[model samples]
Target: MMKLASLGLFVFDASTFPFSDLNRRRDWRYGAAPRIGDRDATQYLGPGDELVTLTGALVPEAGARYGSIKTLATMADQGEAYPFVDGSGVVWGSFIILSMDERRRALLVDGTPRMIDFTVELRRVA
Candidate 1:
């Protein structure tokens, strides 16, 4: 499993982003970022909005792949984008959620990729 260092998230109406393997040394490949339409752009996540969250451990290979997929899937999802890395090799994972009204946080340990469920939400910590 991998560790979580810091996370930065951006919410946009829409964005076009390229994809590349986080662990592999390669240039950006053609990809897209999820976007918010003009109408939805006005709806801001405020300090009162509830934030839903999920957490788990992930192997390095699968962790990077999950991260890449979340980055690559923005075109269709068009909601929020979050990317984080631990930089330390410890592989301990941590997660936090900033909602319209509150913040939630959790810690995780290294584990296999079988637990990952892409259909629900993509949680990746490198």
Candidate 2:
């Protein structure tokens, strides 16, 4: 099996939790100064913010555990940054979990979800 990516100890792979889509956003900071007779002078401050969003689905029949979401929540509660690295060994940076949203679908008689779709949002801290 091929590894997709990893955030700390949580690995994204075919057997575990595989992400269907990955989105990244990078922003730059700028400052504007008022001018007497011309347009405001804009100065590039530096980098503003960086964010990453991972969306995937978890299927119990496919070996994905629902507790994995809880694990991520625990990591978020710790308020610590984790290194985001791809399968090719590219280190994105240290990031903190900003939010996680999940939707349960195809419920069973016991009220357990047959599939859980989730989105994880992360912010670069380092």
Model 1 per-residue lDDT tens digits across residues 1-126: 222333343221112111111221112233344566633223433332222232332233333333433543542254444453333633323223332111212324543343232212233322
- Encode model 2's per-residue lDDT on 1-126: one tens digit a residue: 788999998888866676899999999999999999999999999998999999999997887778888889999999999999998989999999999999999999998999999999999999
Q: TM-score, each model?
A: 0.18, 0.94
| Each candidate: RMSD | 17.3, 1.1
Candidate 2: RMSD to truth: 1.1
Clash counts for the predictions, in order? 15, 0
- After superposition, the stretches of candidate 1 with alpha carbons farther than 4 Å from their true spots are 1-48, 61-64, 67-69, 72-77, 80-126
Top model number, TM-score: 2
